[model samples]
Target chain A: MTDVQTQPAISTAQPEDFFQLLKPRVMSLVVFTAATGLVVAPGSINPLVAAIAVLCIAVGAGAAGALNMALEGETDALMRRTRGRPVAAGRVKKNDAMAFGVILSLFSVMLLGMNANWLAAGLLAMTIVYYAGFYTLLLKRRTPQNIVIGGAAGAFPPVIGWAAATGQAPWQAWLLFAIIFLWTPPHSWALALYSAGDYAKAGIPMMPVAKGAKSTRLQILLYTLVFVPVAIAPAFVGLGGLIYLVVSVAGGLGFLGLALRLYRSRAGDEPDKAEAVGREAALYDVRAQAKPARDLFAFSILYLMALFSALLVEALSGLGA
Target chain B: MRLTPEELRARKRRNVWIAAALVAFIVLVFGTTVLRLQQNQASERALLEAATGTTAQ
Candidate 1:
């Protein structure tokens, strides 16, 4: 008789499953922001090399995402928002995802170093380690301030892009970094306030789950107050121009209004709509009580995109040059 | 010693993808090397021109 225990398991994973492990949606945002930094930095690079730099940054971000999913598969299974992820859904094995992440990480960092400067490559490597090792393994389960700290991983791509272009990370690059770093708390907490149920189910210490929704709302308002001025600061500092000034001011006001509305509302005071209904909830299909939080969450993404797009336009047109 | 048809198909497709990814990586490396060489040569030429002009002065 054949010994079944000695045989290697056959994999049914398709390429789509592997792609899903990269978190394509998040990668798109990374690519956009990194591209903006490359375009706006005060230096010129060969177009092909610039494209390669952005590609490496995107792949590096994706690699970190793959590693995050591989490590958090079981935990992800318990959360509705993340349950459909490839590793969590069993479409991709955890070990396979881990290997994929490591391979991509190595290739991206090495290629980026050869194409750009080592400073950019080193930043990409640090971002991977920060997200996959420090944030995923250590901070996520231990603190309610997890996203606040872990958000640095998301904020590094622009700096890497700037360094790729100039081989130096000056205050201008860090100003861009600060905008994302501060924007993260409000954006994340707004989503967390609406999805507190899923976070609770997964035993994650999201602000809404750990500190209650009232505190979360207050903190979101406070953060919005701080984040907007910084978002507008780029204009005064000569890093941004008229178009950016308009976008940041208008979008920042709208963001503030939404935060205020969300703060005054009773959103997140109850379990999430999915929990209440005992079923999966569409990301945008929240209950009337939760709509304010949802509005802030949705608007936050639009506002950030507009702000970055304005900067990109100004730079490309030589208005900010 | 038997494998299901679905398993065989998936394995074949995966192998194809792996080959594609490897080819893409090789092309990227080769392109990057060529670009770097061109950049270095251009900068070296510029430096030589500057030195020759200074010597003439």
Candidate 2:
């Protein structure tokens, strides 16, 4: 999968391109969840310290993203969806991206250790290693169950945030981690369902490419069924309140409903679930199969955002008091 | 190391930002530590005064 990309010699890379390398959209979610973890935990943090913690999480997330892009430049170039990424497109040199990620990772971890507690900094370091070293390097290329395990990396942000506030991760913080962990299979598999061709072309073992779209759809529905309860568990665990309860129950129903729709989208001409065909839009007939996956992908983002927003608002309002 | 003017200016700005952030964090941590120590001392003084019927001052 090694492609010799002709990088720009002088590297006229702009600040914006470097910013884009961070995968800002993903980092926003990381920052939001981490801030929610900090706020909802049962202690007070200095606002400055909280801000520094969130900034560290954001940078760590970005560092992971850049490193992922740098390492996957070859595969990314082969996939249409990611072909234009800075490292893949040679807008930024691969070595430069690697250096940028390593430096940011160091700065973020050290800053967090100094400003917050070492527990928070240690978790941040683990997140970087889990994502950049484990998930991107080993898991993503090896298994159809890649996201199921790799989801732990994304799920750690809330725990890190809680540790930042209280210097300890109680069971409640891990419940929040479970919410995101279970949420990942469905969210990513939906994207994988539609982008199966990209993965197949790049020789990645994404679920839809390895296990077929039919099984992927079924798994999406199953994971969402499991996701709803965990997403709502915070309310009973004291991490959430009336507002969070309302949002979780309502938002969860929407998520489950969409998953069921995606599962049932495979109508009378459904392909055999056992056929080990490499994924292609044409093979599955995207005109019939793609919409539900796309809808679920979009809705998943909204569901997480709304759930976390309610938690943030409740925490800020002193719900525990 | 020899560097061009524009590159040198940008490097200077980035370094300045990093330094300022570090300094601010150090001040916050230091101030909080001092405040915690002072509060502990005051509480101890109050306890002693209550026991002895005499303020430390």
Candidate 3:
């Protein structure tokens, strides 16, 4: 609505452009968390069935990514960070990407139903719809809390994995879901704090764009505080082991420490790696200042990885499950 | 059909995605089929064992 959606086509479409539309990086995270859910479940699954389940999850995630890119083509064209995406860059046609998404979505869900259980297929189907329909089309452009509510879409992977393994999703699976759901706010807020202008320009109402940085930072701290306790709960509830307890508590504290640092370090003009160009609309030299936002953003990745890895290790060792 | 260079390029791109998707589909479906057959065979073996008062040695 801000401007005309269509832009002049630039380059011809290429194979790599189609591949890029899948957002493989995000797909890998989905695959990992979903696989962990399968592995850590109580009963053993046949390896072949397990592989099929994981692959279906990966395909479903990639399908959703394609659909997201197809919808966001216009805004993606406007943002410098997303300007080079397949549809936005004019490398692939919108119809082709959309067809690719719809086909993959159906294929993955059907395969999961055939290979795994109908429960898993249903969960995967809902996840695809939640992400591509509710989050991308409805929530993203409309509200600042879009990521907060939409975070459930990403959180569903572990639950789907659990369902695939046991044909049921109990409360423990939801605990894992809660960890990722809570982690999303701080993780995305860090990116949003650094890229506030990009969101503003794209007409997306992200938290940092609607609320000031100070408010967003404080909220990030609040979420981390809540996340750390919930993250440590699995061990106390007998779902995880000592290793998970240590990892969760340590990683949670590290995250909290970083959040506190970000709150206090209100220095002027630092070259954040996240901005790449500048901080707060001003492009400055490389030797500008320290950037806590970028630091927290990087550490959040490690935090989740460590938390999940601990549970996986303990489960594999027969100490957690 | 005769086509422009841009049209040909677009077609090629779409083909690549389709080919990749086909490969993935085959792999996933093949695995599922094999696993389902394996499970069926295992259950049949267990039923045979139960009927014969013997187990696989």
How well is each residue in A129-211 modelled by candidate 1, as lDDT tens digits? 99999999999999999999999999998899999999999989999999999999999999998889888989999999999
Candidate ordering by TM-score (highest first): 1, 3, 2
Model 3, position A157, has a per-residue lDDT of 89
DockQ of model 3 vs. true complex: 0.45
Stretches off by above 4 angstroms in model 1 are: A1-9, B54-57
Residue A177 lDDT in candidate 1:
91
Which of the two candidates, 2 or 3, achieves a greater TM-score against the reference? 3
How do the residues A1-321 of candidate 2 rate in per-residue lDDT, one tens digit apiece? Answer: 234243222455656667888999999999999999999898687786788789889999999999999899999988766888999887788998999899889888987887678999999999999999999999998999999999999999999999999989989899989999999999999878777767787999998889888888899988998899999988887888888899999999999999999998862123333222533233334445567887888899999999889999988987641
- TM-score list, all predictions: 0.96, 0.83, 0.87
Clashing pairs in 3: none
Native contacts retained per candidate? 0.79, 0.00, 0.57
Global CA lDDT computed for model 3: 0.83
lDDT of 3 by residue, A83-118 (tens): 889999877778889988998899999999999999
Best lDDT goes to which candidate? 1
For TM-score, candidate 1 versus 2, the one ahead is 1
CAPRI quality level assigned to candidate 2 from its DockQ score = incorrect
